[model samples]
Target: MKAIVSVKRVVDYNVRIQVKPDGSGVVTDGVKMSMNPFDEIAMEEAVRLKEKGKITEIIAVTIGGAKNEETLRTALAFGATKAIHIKDEGEVQPLTAARALAAVFKKEGASLLIAGKQAIDDDANQTGQMVAALLDIAQATFAGKVDVDGNKATVVREVDAGLETLEVDLPAVITADLRLNEPRYLKLPDIMKAKRIPIEATTLADLGVTAAAAVKTVKTVPPPSRSKGVMVKTVDDLVAALKAKGLA
Candidate 1:
């Protein structure tokens, strides 16, 4: 079996985000960038599968600017055999990203494609499903547990109430949830070796697919500021306030 994991470069979750002065997007000045957390889980799972002798190869792919090569190298340090980068300097729509990934999946003849259930920055949970739809293959999203046997795979997904399991044939897509295995940190040796690994680059046009204009951002507005709450010294005061507001 061969596994392909899709990764992304995103602003560090710990950094404070500020809107650009021009109101175009977030101000990236002096902000640190790191690999998406959920994608880390997906890559870790792929590496585990390879370690178990269940998968023959693990490939990492990403779509973004040149700086995204750092994210791909991080994936390589985690145990991926090769990397593919789809160069797109501007923001890419979810549909376009899915389409581009699907093209690469076809070209590489991947047996399984794993990606995060959603990107933390965009919170767009469409890419994995869209890629599965484009390829006309099975998909299991929000997967908390995954087990592969022979040509069949079983996945346990987290639902609102609890968990649900689904079985699918090979050549499927799986989007990992938070409950998946924890991602491993790269050792110094691996990090040094990853820098020497070659990364293949491709353009959107090279895939014979045009980027689909699926969604557009109109404007970004800051969330409303919260007001201070009044302190109630006693139950009587609470009741009085509620009655004044017609809530009691």
Candidate 2:
């Protein structure tokens, strides 16, 4: 079975996010960028499936400019059989990205799609579901554990109530959750091999996809700093303090 993994290039999670000085957006210049952490987990899961002989081929696809090839290279190092780069320089919103991905998925005739539940940068948490909707196929989100058997994928997902299990037919979409699996570290040899595999590139227009309406950022601001806490020895004192602050 061929599997398509959507890898999103995002600011590294470890970096402290900085809003743009003019209140336009988050700063990305000179920032450390990496694959969406959740997408890394998704990639790991796809590799695991391939290792178990359940997946015949794994293709990693990412949308962005030339720089996004770095993210695709990492995916290749992780075990993706090939990489596809959808070239788009503009800001790619969720629905538009979903359209781009869905186009690639169909073009490749992939049987399964795996992606991060959310991108760390935007935290939109919408692309995976949107892709499923566009494809008119079954979908499972926030999957903590996934097992593929024949034409069905059994997914264990986390929910507000607790956990939910789903069995979806093949050619379905699944989004990886935090506890999905730990991504393996990249080895120097694998990284070198990944460098040689040319990433196939295409434009959104080439795939008959178009950018959606642009999102205008009114302004950007940081959260207010917290007030200093007061020490209260007794529960009564705590209550009194809360009452003083009009928070009780």
Give the candidate number with the greatest TM-score.
Answer: 2
Q: Output the worst ten-in-a-row residue range by lDDT, candidate 1.
A: 216-225
* C-alpha RMSD between model 2 and the true structure: 1.6
User: Compared with the true structure, what per-residue lDDT tens digits does model 2 show for residues 35-99?
Assistant: 99999999999999999999989999999988999999999999999999999889899989999
User: Candidate 1 — which pairs collide?
Assistant: none
Query: What CA root-mean-square deviation does each model show from the true structure?
Result: 2.1, 1.6
Question: Which 10-residue window in model 2 sums to the lowest lDDT?
Answer: 214-223
**Would you list the C-alpha lDDT of every candidate in the order shown?**
0.91, 0.94
Best-performing candidate as measured by lDDT: 2
C-alpha lDDT of residue 229 in model 2: 82
Encode model 1's per-residue lDDT on 89-201: one tens digit a residue: 87788898898989999999998999999888889999999999999999999999998888888999999989999999989999999988988878999999999999999
Candidate 1: global Cα-lDDT?
A: 0.91
